[model samples]
Target chain A: MSATPTPSPAHAPDAAPHADGTSALLHAEGLHKTYGSTPALAGADFSIRAGEVVAVMGPSGSGKSTLLHCLAGIVPPDSGRVLYRGRDLSALSDAQRSALRRGDFGFVFQFGQLVPELTCLENAALPVRLAGAGRKQAEAQARQWLERLEVDDIRHHRPGQVSGGQGQRVAVARALAARPSVVFADEPTGALDSLNGERVMQLLTEAARDSGAAVVLVTHEARVAAYSDREIVVRDGKARDMSAMAGVA
Target chain B: MSISHTLLGLLETGPRHGYDLKRAFDERFGHDRPLHYGQVYSTMSRLLKNGLVEVDGIEAGGGPERKRYAITDAGITDVEEWLATPEKPEPYLQSTLYTKLVLALLTDRDASSLLDTQRSEHLRLMRELTRRKTHGDLADQLICDHALFHLEADLRWLETAAARLDKLAKEVRR
Candidate 1:
């Protein structure tokens, strides 16, 4: 977690290379992200192992979100590459990229994006159904995830009915329902109080380790970053070596 | 370093049963600046409130009251940061201990008592460093050599001061 990734280490890293140049699960070299004329990321270089939790942090507009989006194939990077399990995401076709996004990555933003009108269980299971899973079985899997996350009691409640912490926990269970290899979460605990924030952070770190899914959590709070195994700080759209104190794991 | 800073460093080593931490601190650091029991427990409580360290469990009875403390990620972040930032060790030279020793010459207490303490400390440190240099390999080569030089300088200073005291003949006493 302390070492740098290899140069041009194959696409879709299954494990991150150490400082000595070993293999990693994901690697991005010379990664650059821009929006029209403004640069959101500048030739950023970062990587994560298959089951390692790496937190990315920075000041507002430092390009954390853009980097996450670029890595997940939700947005294309201006330059550089996003390699997942040996394939360059930028080189994949749109449908192939979509399939990867739907099947290989799980995302959770500050907003859980749960359908407000739907029951918590339905909201969590809907993604499974959309992924072509049978409804009953999908919900059963969803229920299991809910129970695992300690949100099973809220299965029939709406997002509005649960506490912020409980809602986010549900969101996490939903994201993990399909067992994606990676989970990109932005400010997962930003909306909660310190008590609840700590609870959520612990849950996230536990989830990543238990599921063997690498995590790229983004945040500005040092307390949140303390939960991560390692962290990379972004500044002026470039990934920089953060001294210590910065994201959520 | 201050007692509080040392306490924080001890807590940074992963969760330790409070009593065990106290013993480790005493064994490793307290010889120089002993951490009072009250101070150690107080610091533990403060660290817990600050979310840097946590109490994992409590022993059922008096078997040292398993007050295990662990360094949270935030705590690691803190120490990582401390290692990164430059430390100003020169200030320690002018700390209260040295200043008090220097001022002791103006009082009725025999300077021999203070000299005895300093001489004992210097010899002990020199012996420890010599043993380490001969057998234990330091992880950082340059830093270890630098530390050895610093200790050597302290020993030399102590020897010179002891000679100066012997030559004074009570002239500067009154």
Candidate 2:
């Protein structure tokens, strides 16, 4: 009754890199997470160097999002170590982790998540302001990012007033405005049409690269994943890196 | 990509020399694979023999004589028929990948890994096309989009096949 195919050289475990992730900006080892008897992540290992865009790809509920949360320190893994620049996330205090997330990390979700009451410029400047910068200085930084994302004209408009594409660009501007070292984007283009999606990805990746920010992109779409430098495919709570397997034919 | 038909259709716009025809085709349809001079001349000669085009005039150029071609009435009808006729859809029911998968399963090889490798290769090409599309002109975008869609369709099929691999392996083994 064994339906499993025999392992070949292409499937050799050695093809993947060691989980220690010595030089990675963000690294996770043997991560395990569960919620109410449902296992979200069994044992996933991941790593991303500075300025590298890595895609996390899997089917629905395949622990890709869980891996991202753990990597970003939003959700602590039950029994694993997530290290950011040699500092373990689990060892950090709540306030310290929050500071790290705000100061060193940026985020973009499927929905732009721009505050309805705030104008786009205000929304983009929120991160800079959170870091205790003055209002004028924060808005100036946000203004530069908005112009780079090509949504500066709509800076005064509220999130509800702009098109989906423009709103997403504004979201991107917000993410990059803070000058974070890493950007965690979960389905950043999922809500836009093809043309819009392409534009968003182009801007997001280009801005991230220009600023030397690593991107942990989580997506199920191959087209979206194409923007990444490489991909990690998560299935049944385990993660597999596909970059090493590129040599296979 | 019927070159003769395309050449004839281009001639419909107006009389054009062999050199002009090549430039037109390359500008419009030849983003990746431009028409060689030999190909253009050969296609034009074929069309002329078929009475779809006639030599309107000849220009004595510095290098050689350039014959200007104009589409005949029959050429217009041909172009019209080509435009109206729907191209046959490629089913690819017996694709090489399917054969390779079945063979891998029959030989007790790692079919799952094979699928993953293929998926990676497909995505690699897709990434290249996406990069080109990002920096290319409108025509380049359109052409890349067509390829990207087809590759996406193939990827979708690959995912489905991966999910059903065990069932397929069982069936094929039985």
Candidate 3:
């Protein structure tokens, strides 16, 4: 609504440190990953601040998912470093990285990935439960998140019983239930129709902002990426920050 | 948009002075560009001359004389026809972006970067529209959605162009 554009809090890709000198919540530099004989990421660089939604966009197999995997410590890069809150992810033990993921990071995939056997409420509470909270406390927190995401009415149903849109909302509620500092969402709205997709994006973004959690969203759809504060385009295994590019041009 | 037809439609509800018509037009339709008083009066005069509207009353105000106008039966028929007609879809066979891309290749410039810059510009507008839609009412949301979809189409073209830049460069040089 303001005449001036909203200034992005995300750090520029090429900058060694941010202009303001504040460290990013998660940062990766010169990352390279290979699967068999193919290179997924050659030399990608990325950074995100707390509460900033940065969409990772590219054509299929262009390494957007690889960049996200490296950032989240799910897949180690062959040649570069990833820092989470100034702590090197590679330096941590495998157990430590897993622990960090459980306690400090959240994830939402295109398929929702809800447990087919668990009730929606139980599925939403799984992350918090795994993070060492008591079942009652975890379920209570998850219930609140489910309500906020507008899927609480279907809390007693299993994943198979709910609609795709409702299931996706439950997955989002699960991701936020642990109060993670960052949420890694890869095509969270990819499976839904435009109306359902937009609604999911609206709720996901609004809930993430309210929780003050940064989102590294991997999406090829421009409409979905539009929900992000800024975007990084991964081409040929490299990342380019569109906002930073705009600033330079 | 046809300002005269729009003004006539507004008058269909009831007779309104020129100033009141402008305000109503602005509130409902004019968002980015509001109707100027001169444009409103000129449009009203044209509609009156065309038998689409008639002067219902004249009121002498403190500053100037105000004329209240009402829509005629002809105006209602005109609005119906306009509403029923489907707008022609633009083919965009010749695109400015295509021209710029070809020129960049011809001039030995960084065509890929040009596409990147344009893509950024397009996303910037999309982001603005997205934010507006987040806080806007349903009407605002629909309007922004239309603009957002168009910009998204442009961005998709940019992506495809970037992917085929090498092939395009080969053809342009030959």
lDDT of 3 at B15: 91
Question: lDDT tens string, model 3, A141-216?
Answer: 8888888888988999999999999999999989888878889999999999999999999988888877678899
C-alpha lDDT of candidate 3 relative to the true structure: 0.86
Identify the runs in model 1 with alpha carbons over 4 angstroms from their true place: A1-22, A241-249, B1-174
- After superposition, the stretches of candidate 3 with alpha carbons farther than 4 Å from their true spots are A1-22, A247-249, B62-65
Model 2, residue B91: what's the lDDT? 77
Winner on lDDT between 1 and 2 is 2
lDDT by residue (tens digit), candidate 1, B1-174 = 555556667777667877677788777655445666677778778878888777777767744345777788887777677768887767445544345545676565666456445534443444344334334444432343456566656645554464566455365555
CA displacement after TM-score superposition, residue B14 of candidate 2 (Å): 2.6
- Per residue, candidate 3 scores C-alpha lDDT tens digits across B1-174 of 788878888888999999999999998889789988999888888888999988888877632228888899999999889878997898978999999999999899999999988887888788889999989999899989999989999999999999999999999999
> Which residue pairs in model 3 clash with each other?
none
The superposed Cα distance between candidate 3 and the true structure at residue A228, in angstroms, equals: 0.7
lDDT by candidate, in order shown: 0.69, 0.86, 0.86
**Residue pairs in clash, model 2:** none
